[model samples]
Target: MILHLVSSPPQINLDLTDCVSNSESDATLQHNCLHVTGSIDKETDSRQFISYCMNEYSPKWNIQSNSRERKFTFVELYKHNITSRHLYLWSAPMDVAERYQFYLDQLSISNEASMATQLFYNCTPPRFGPICQYAFDDYRPDHLSLNEIIHDFYLHGYEPTTLTCYVHLQCDRGPAPACLDWSEICDGKVDCLDGGRDEEHCWQLEANECADDQYRCVNGQCIPYTFFRDNTAIPDCLDGSDEYFESKDKRANCKIAESVFECEDLTCTIGHRSWASPLTSSCAQSRSDLLIKAMFLHKPNSVLDECWSAFLCIIHGSNPSDTICGDFCVGQTFNHERKTVRSSYGIKIEF
Candidate 1:
């Protein structure tokens, strides 16, 4: 005798009976039967058992088995013709001959039944035809082959057939380029089946142009000017976009000193000489003229001398004659009295 137990909610009680004649002469009958020995609670429903079966044992039953005596059974109890939930059982008869034969037939007929339930247990039904079904909005299957679908199912344990079908349909119908290919398609140009490339195309310029205070188009994108460094004397942008141009010698109408002393044309001694004499002389002449004009306009003499001297001190070196002095007096300076004496004698004295 073999015992098979099927445990599920809304428990079903099953009894197996076999009658044998023990003594031929007396015609005596012997009865052997299996009965449900344990009581089942009604509250332990089929739904809970089905959930457990699907979660716990589904993966184990996915493999193929060659044994006949071992078989798995799934049963659902019903109330008023509606199946409440499902239950599963693993059974093998102690009578090896009968058990082996039954299991062998079961294995041959339904190898993937358990696995299929597990794979599709939580999956939503496909809502569209072959080409319109997909698991996610952006996912499509037009490019996936049948072999790919089987491989995906085996590896991921999910059916992506509907997704693949939808993808293929879109590909055939020339739907919008999938989001995955946006980079390739929108590479500064428009590439879509609907002649909608213009809407998607954009340009991006390099940073170098912005640093130059210039607006430029690079790769179909407009780049505005920007400053790269602060406190620069010259405008960074040749186009004058970064720091706007004001007067010819002044920017923003802030008076700028004239750049008259270019180093290239200047000789070493002559250069220093000009800095002391000619430059000083020119500055002095301008200051004297300004003072005379101010005095003619009734400006005070006190104000005139202070302003004139201060102006001369900046534009001319403090010791204006030092550059033209002989080797012994190269860096020497005369006192005010000696300078007055030299000027009175018409002497070309150097400081």
Candidate 2:
């Protein structure tokens, strides 16, 4: 059996190698120590033996056996709740403290110890002393911890100075000047800068009175309708502006004569005598006599001269004496003879 002492300052690891088949004997021999028996080569199987000793023996130190070697060798430590200030001892056939020291030296040189130290320092609290009010108030870990610190500062009503500086720079720039030009060129007025009296002059058509259809202005003169067609039929102008007045008057008189004395029947009355008689003269003789008298009155020749004056007088409503009628009958003697021959032959004659 082996006896070992366990302390409280630093945690200790147990070694399981001896006290295999003599577990009961070793337990009775070491009164205050724990006993372990197991094949340490199989670590999982050895844990059962270690668990059994830890549960049954409530000692601070114990020993384990090696089954393959058939020898009792290693020591084990078993503590209820160890802290960093605890210490433990081992009693065995060999110097177990030296073995523990050698084991600790190997552990100290391992990569796990260095990594554990880094993690431990990283989790330690900051040195803010009594000012640390919250649980994580003084907990900072370089760059990672500084990010959380700044975030918390903003949460606790801390405003950065850069924001105020930016606002002040904007105000110092000031408002821009007004770019309006008050010259007449851009003031909605027509500016005559090129020496003209007005900007632009316009011409418009004449007034409504100048467009009258009855009085058209020709060559700046107001000519009446007679001057337009040059017709002498009548003075179409009420003012008689046409120069051929005599010709217009004669034409007017002829139109009047044609309107008043146009032949309506076979016989016509000329100063109480029928100038175209169908009884005393045949129809042909009467028509011939009237045609001859009309021609003589219109254009009188030397043969028609003696009767022309009387015929004109009768046509103008003058009374013809018996002597004028005798002269007219003498001029119509051939026409009377042809009418007598047509009457004797029983032939109907027409003018």
Candidate 3:
């Protein structure tokens, strides 16, 4: 069936809501009833014919009209060859199997049985639909498409169930762009260098009483009593709370038996003892063996940093007295120390 209409153009408004409502339930137009308009220009022709195929076309509309108006406009230069009608509307048969497959994909279900099972498990009373994707927004009747409803269901249904907390190891904050480690929390220093979050609420740690063998750091961390005021500038506490009395430079100026020792960057202990005080001095003048032993005590697992520190000692004319430094520094081992360095991929390597 063809519906003939005349209009003046630059544009023509077409309303098919009435026609579709009045049409037979099984009778469908070739053009999708939901959208029934085509473009034509005044230069082409003033009169335009909209053709509709009746029984030959199958209906694809999954919605029923409840007096809702469907209006459309046809406007634009006529680009195609002139034909009997400006617009041909045809009906298409809905492929049940294909439509079922599409519904399966949208619901993320393999079949009806699976969908039913999921709906049963995930949905509670008064919530009925595929995957229990419906929410009560007030009990009101409204026109909505199946696709739109399914999309809303998918959004709420497939949301992540596991909660995650990401830590950004920056002291300052704008965008984190990084993650933090849980172990870094309350370890002593400001782990979140930009924001110093790890150092937050550290005073709370002080409330705990320390044992006789433990020395309490300012941040409330307790360490071996021997580690307290042990002449090393490196604070056993991450916050450097233990070294507040003397700075690295001040400690470097100490006189050992009337010999003034000034260290440029590195700090070392004089004796082979792990708990010995750190004396700042040039790597060449410091005892390399003692430095290595101290490093091992401070960071036992940090083989890479230990080797690197040993190399600096060797470069400064101090012998490491062992091939372990050579084995690690020369790539004989693949262990990494991320504490002191970062890989090219931005992975933190603690030495």
Residue 210 C-alpha lDDT in model 3? 86
What is candidate 2's lDDT per residue for 1-351, written digit by digit as tens?
222134211112222322323454344332212233222222322222222122233243353322222111112221122112222221221223334344445555763332121100001123211111112343444423323443343345332221101111112111111111111111122222233222122111112133344343221224444344454332222222332333312322221121111111111212212332322121123233333333332332332344344443334323444655544455433122222111111122321
Error of 2 at 277 (Å): 29
lDDT by residue for model 3 over 1-351, one digit each (tens)?
A: 122243212111122322333345535333211221111222221222233222322333443432222212111101122111332211111221123334345544433333222111112322322222223453223313322332243334232222112334344311222233343455444435355776687677868778999988654678888867654433464334455433433432322111112122222333321222322122222232333333333323434555545444433323544565554455443354433542211223334
User: Which is better, 1 or 2, measured by TM-score?
Assistant: 1
lDDT of every predicted structure (CA atoms)? 0.25, 0.26, 0.34
Ordered by lDDT, highest first, the candidates read: 3, 2, 1
User: lDDT of model 3 at residue 289?
Assistant: 31
State the displacement of the C-alpha of residue 290, model 3, in Å, after optimal TM-score superposition. 35
- Cα RMSDs, all models: 38.4, 67.3, 30.3
Clashes (backbone N, CA, C under 3 Å), per candidate, total: 12, 27, 29
Greater TM-score among 1 and 3 belongs to 3
